[model samples]
Structures are given as C-alpha cells and as structure tokens.
Target: MSTPPPRRASAAVASPTAPLIGLGAGAPVLAFDVGGTDIKGALFGEDGHIRCLARIPTPVAGDRTGQAVIAEIVNLAGRFAEVQPSVNPRALGLVVPGHIDTRSGTAVFAENMGWKDVAFRERVSALTGLPVHFGHDVRAAGGAEFRLGAATGLRDVVVVVIGTGIAGALFVDGRPYDGDGLAGEIGHAKVASGPTCACGGTGCLEAVASAAAIARRYSALTGAQVAGAKEVLDRSQAGDPDAKLVWKDAVDALALSFSHVVALLAPEAIVVGGGLAEAGPALLSPLTARLDEYLTFQRRPRILAARLGENAGLLGAAIGARELMVAGGTR
Candidate 1:
C-alpha cells in the first residue's frame, strides 16, 4: 500500500524556532520530542535541513494520555505535510521522556506524563504508515551532542540535561551505552540524604540540584517565591545570602554526583544542557572546582554548555528517523 500524496502547504515554516546547522545531506524525516508539557515537531528535508519547526502544547488526557499524545503526533504529521506536499517524509523519529525500551519501541513509564506500556514505535508506524524510530528524550539529545555538538570528537562523554529535572546520556568509545534503557540515570544517584525526589527516592541528585529544585530550595530558605532557578541564580549573584546558600548546595550535590560519574564511567567530557546550563561559567566553574576537590588522581571531565540548546533532542529524533530509512525498516 502507498500513501496518497499530501496537499501542499501554503507557507514554508511559520515559526522557525531552531536553527538549521550541523545537519548535512540525509533522508527527509519528521521528528518530535515530546516532553511533559510541550512537544517539539520538526520537518527535515532530503537535504538534511530543517524546513519547519513548531512547538505544540502536550494534551493532558488523564488515562488516555499515551493515546492522546499519539493522536497529536499523527495530526502534526499531517500539518507538516500541508506545509510541503512535495517533500513527503519517509520516516519519523519520536522521543519521549521516560523509561523507554528502544528495542521494543515501548514507553515503559513516565510519572509526569501519565503514560505506561505504550508501544510508540508500533503505534506511530501503523498510524502514519511510516517507519518510526523511538527513543528516550535525554539519551537522544545526548546522541546529538555526541555527534555534532559539545562532545564532538570525544570518545567518552556524558550529556547532562538540567531542566525542571535532570537526566544524562552516556557515551563510551564513541557510541551510546544504554544498559537496556537504564544506563545514564545520573539524576537518581544519591548525592545527599536530604530532600525526597519525585521518584520516591531519598537524596536523588535532581531533587537537590535540578533547576526546579534550586528555585524551590531558595524559596524555602528565604521565604520568597522565585520564578525559576535563573531568578535564584540572579539573586545569588546580586549578593542575596539565602539565594547563595541554595545555589551552593545545589552545586555541591551536582559535583558529588559528577564525581561518581567520573569515577565510574570516566567520561572525558560532561556536556551540560537544558535550562540550568544557561548559567554558563557560573555553573561549570563552581562544578569543576568542587569536582576537583572530590577526586584524587582521577580524570576531571571538561564541562561545557551544549551548543544545540533545546533542539538537541529534535535533532537526535531526526537522526534516528533517517537511520530507520537507511536500515530499510518500515511498517
């Protein structure tokens, strides 16, 4: 069976949110990075250029959560088709945050997204009649970094994304090392026996060091509600004593976690991404110093901000889609 030719879209890309860089010639593919709140969708042309980028609010559909998200993805594919009927995408890369089993293309679970046991790859492939490649969001984003961004040329790397929550993607010997979708869960590493994490685990690193945690910790300390971690960071920079204390604690927890990663994985580079990485030197400088104090005769990773920003996951999704086409896999 063949797909009917899609109608041409009137305008190219209405909202070009991310830049088209680093991507060269490759198969045309549709890509999506579904988060707990927002979903990023992109259309890549045969030239490996991003032709369209759109941010869509994820639907909160209670028990129908996975089904609702899949419906939205199918709808987005149609919308992308209308933009350029001539450029029919052959494959799709869909990444979602959770305990994803890429081997079976199953989304095992996501606490925030309210989904479990969703065979995303099979569902998307059957619905759109396009080969679908699925993966974990953080791991996919880490792949983009390993191939094209901050960790480029490094054989061993860890891509850490510090947003509302924190997660990591591990790369060793120039390849992603996913221990059956459970490898790089650095965020859950016990850094201190303090706050309870969302994962119901005590002393999880993200509970203390993540962007949301930083803001919450600051608000608890100073009795002042902050907009986000950036606000807390700014307050700290402006000589706010409470803010400084919160920030320092977060850094210390992060360093403690990284020290473990360095000692274990021994990644040469730890490329940081997401909202907290926006702090640049403010975060890395302190983190490096703290990590140094923890290690003796251990390789200190060169920490840097991710170049692709939020688009790293989207690019990783695109790469996965194109690979599917190359492998001649289709539903």
Candidate 2:
C-alpha cells in the first residue's frame, strides 16, 4: 500500500477550538472504531464535523468468525449512508483493537475479539464499494491525540490508553512508529511476577494497571462485586484499604512501564487516555510523583490527560481515510 502524504502541519497540531476534529478539507468519509466491547462510528463531513454518530455492541459473542464482524461494519455503513442521502462518503476508515499489519491492511491478531490474519481493508472495501483505510485502534486514537488533541505540537511522544486493556502509540519526529504491528504492546510487558494474563502470560502490565485489572483485583481481594475502576478509585478515596492497595499497585506498575519508555524513547510527553484516565487528578498526581521517583537523569516527560475522550479513534479513522484519498491519487 502506498503511504499517504504527510498531514498538513495544521492538521497535525491541535487547534484551540475543537481540537479533536481534524483540520483538512476533503470529501466526506465514513469511519469505524471497533473495540473489544463496542463499535463507535461516524461520518465526517468536508467541514470537519462528525454526523450520525452511533455505537453498537461488538459481534464477538454472537459471531465466532471474523466474517460476521466485517458484515456488521458494512451494515452500519449502509445505515449511515441511508440516513444521510445528501452526503456521500468518498472512502471508509476502519480501526480495530489488535496486532494490525497496516501495510497489508490485515488484522493480524486480537485475543479479545478472537480473530487473526483477517484482511479487513479488502473485505470492507469490496463490500462497501469505497476505498478503505485500515489501522490499529489504539494507534489510531494516538494519531488523533498527536494531530488533534493532547499530544499535538510534540515531535516525540507516547500516547497511552488505559482502558479494559493498556496500549501505547509512539510518535517520533511527527510520524507514527507502528513497527509492523508490534511497537506498542506495553500492556503485555511484564511488571510483576504472578498474575496471569488472558494472553497466557504472567505478570503483564495489563494484568496490573488496566482499568479492568484494577476492578478484577479489587473484587478478588474483597470478594465483592464493584462497578469498575472508577468505583475502586472512589472506594480508595473513601479510605478502603483494599482499594488503596490495588490502586497503588496500578500506579506503581504504570510508573515502572513509563520509566522504561522514558529511558528508551525519551518522549517529550506521555498523553494518557481511556477509562482510567477519567480519574483526572487522582490518577495524574500520584502517577506524576511516582514517575518522578523512577527517573533519575532521564528527561522526565510531562504527563497529561487525553482531551478527545472516546471519539478520538473515530476522528483518527477519518483522518486516515482523508489521507487515503490523497494516497489513491485523488483529492
């Protein structure tokens, strides 16, 4: 696949007003952000505003095969097209959680969704009859952060999302470093010695610091069902010892992982997103303090919260689709 031209500098930097939206003029594009639990989609108009935003549960449970997932996305696109007859989507951008080989437009692996080596771009394009651009979900979100949200104006940065799982997307010298679908698996990096991961690995960072892991660990310790990580944080604030311990562990794990990133990549900032980041000061304050302790001489990067919220991935897909149009030798 041909590489798209570099995004315009304005497109790569966040604007003061509505930073999450891209800044280019192009034909309207349809975008899908496929996660483990849900699929969020939107149609981005030439004026850089999203329309017909929708969210639906992922078909992972109902459809064991990857084909059904693709079918559902095509169905959603059809619905969007039907709703907006006046606006035609010139291309489509699809992003999914997994090890994605973007060069081949293949979703190489996604343990949560149970699919591997699926040709997502080809399938979606053939079904929708529009040019398609495919990307990894976390990286796509990071792209949005880099170009239109938290990490804008930074050349070297790490955009980390701590949701049901943890992941990072690296941007060095104003370009995303995908590393053939394996660059930012920070969630899988070992941070402890015991907790087993869904990937059949022990002590992975995701097993400790992910929002899902925090709730799971807290529930196991108290033998009580909690709503989610937010609840756990609230419990900690209320002086629950178990919640405090679990939260501390998660913060420690994140600090350790970030220290490694700082040593290696020396990023200017680490822009954090996802459910856990909703803790706001509760997460950032301690994380910053702990991270400070870990860094001795390394250039400590600023830790900041993601500004785009949940729609970052969708906006990123739109950005990729617009770039794809340019790459296809069109507008």
Candidate 3:
C-alpha cells in the first residue's frame, strides 16, 4: 500500500523557476548523474566551469522507465540549450542512486535503475522547464565531500564510494546526515560473511567490498577471466597469490566496513572514492593497517582520498541546484 508516484500521475506543474546562487550567479547548473549504465550530463559553468559533459545509455527498465529517465533529462536539456547558447542555463540538478525521498522529490527505490515510487522532482521539473535539484547519489557525493571534497574541514565525516557499487555519505557538523531519508544507506551495512545482497541484504558492505565485488569475487575465486577492479589491483601488484587473496579480502572488507563506520560515526574522516580509490598506496597502506586492526575504543577516522574525481556527483548536483537557488525554492 505505498505506490502512488509516477510524477503524481501528471499533475504537472513545473514553471516556478527558482535556482541560482554562487558558482558565480546563474546560467549553468544542469548536472545529472542517474546511473545503472549512464546518463551523466553536465554544464556547471558560471566559471566554476564544467561543460556539456555527456554519457547517454540508461533506458531499459520499466514503469515508463521513470518517465523515460525524465525524458532523457529533457533531451539533455535540449542539448544544453543548443550546445551553450551563451550559457544561460536556468537550473537543474539531479543525482540518483536509490531509495531517495529527499523531502518527496521521491524515487523511493532504484535498484540499479529498476525504479519505484518515482516522482523525480515533478518529472524533472515537468520536462526541463528547469528548477529540478534532487539528490542521493551517495548522498550527493556525501554532500560533495562535506562541501568541497575530501571531507573538507572534517567534523565527523564518512564519504566512501568504492564504486561499480558501494555507497556512503554521512556528516554531522558539516551537515548532510539525512536519517529520515534513511541516512546514508552505508552500502547495505552488514559486513560480509557470506554473500547475498542486491539490497535484500545478508552480508552487505556491498556484497563484500565493491568494485563490482572485487571483480565478482575474483571471478568467483580463480576460474580465470579478470578485467575490472584494476585487474585485482594489477594482480596484487604482480605478486599474485590469487591477487593477494583478493586484495586481502577487499581490504579486509573495507577495513571491516571502516570499523563499523568508525564505531558508529565518530567520524573525523573516511573519504575514499570510486574506482577502487585508484589503489593509491595500494589502497591507503593496507587501509591504514586494517583500520588499525579494527580499532579498539574508536576515534580513528582519518582515511581520506577522494578529492572530487568523476565530478563528485556532478559537483553535488550543482551544489544541490545551488541549494534550490538559495532556498527561494526554484525561484
């Protein structure tokens, strides 16, 4: 008994306009993420500069395919208004992962684009008249790494991305914590012990440390065939004892899910980002020595890395559609 969404069945009413502030004041906030293959789109420009970035693909599921992925971002906002007609890009921001209810812009579920409860900001502001801003792609890249990357000033953070599937985004003083929107779904929480997880959960942490579960658990444990997850961190840097036991069991299940999110959010830092955090320091020196051997009394945090690569959820959906144009609500 909880369906009623499909853009409120076309009560379509979008023209309220409101969205513009900073990034240099209007004419370039059209970011979109919406994954499960692709639909990236971008245009940030008011000198903060991103431009017409594109991706495409994502259109196979059902229920009018979430208004056909908002009519392909209203045809990529009419090709970003004919490939930048002097950059007067009104305003639109969107990021999507799953279960987002950010104050009813809906999309209550999205298991890899098989959507449900979809309103997606009044059908993308009624087909791109603009003012769309919606979120939850890893809590808008953990609110763009707590406002400007790598847990900026850091006051209780937890960005985590570990991509091809894995999620994060939590913060306290720097803000972003949305418990009512089901706080950062921490990649389905459970720290893997068996398998099962397509969010039906069992041993989650994205089914044991994601990057497509370390290339499907090292091709289901050595039947050969490897490609992604940087070739299991390049055959565990060429030593290769089954790629160092699947890179030490995906960095000890991501340092035991960062020691249960640093003993339940005492976060001072934990940024890490997608594409296996490019295994820098072989993935931060053994995930800081297995998060200091899975902490004892807490206070650890400081894991860092993600300095907004892959456009940090399109610059946090253009800073949340420039914060709904600084709260005038799509003014």
Best by lDDT: 1
Q: What tens-digit string does per-residue lDDT give for candidate 1 at 145-236? A: 88888888999999999998898999999889989898878889889888998898998999999999999988888789889999999999
Error of 3 at 59 (Å): 12
* TM-score for each model: 0.94, 0.91, 0.35
Candidates 1 and 3 compared: the better one by lDDT is 1
**Superior candidate under lDDT, 2 versus 3:** 2
Give the alpha carbon lDDT tens digit for every residue of 184-290 in model 2: 89999898885999888999999999999999999999998999999999999999999999999999999999999999999999999998999999999999999
Go through the candidates in order and give each one's C-alpha lDDT: 0.87, 0.86, 0.76
lDDT of 3 by residue, 208-272 (tens): 77888777888888877788878878887888788788778778878988888788778888888
Q: State how far residue 329 of model 3 sits from its true place (Å).
A: 32
Give the total clashing residue pairs for model 2: 0
Ranking by lDDT: 1, 2, 3
Highest TM-score, which number? Answer: 1
Cα deviation of 189, candidate 3, in Å: 4.4
Sorting all predicted structures by TM-score, with the top scorer first, yields 1, 2, 3
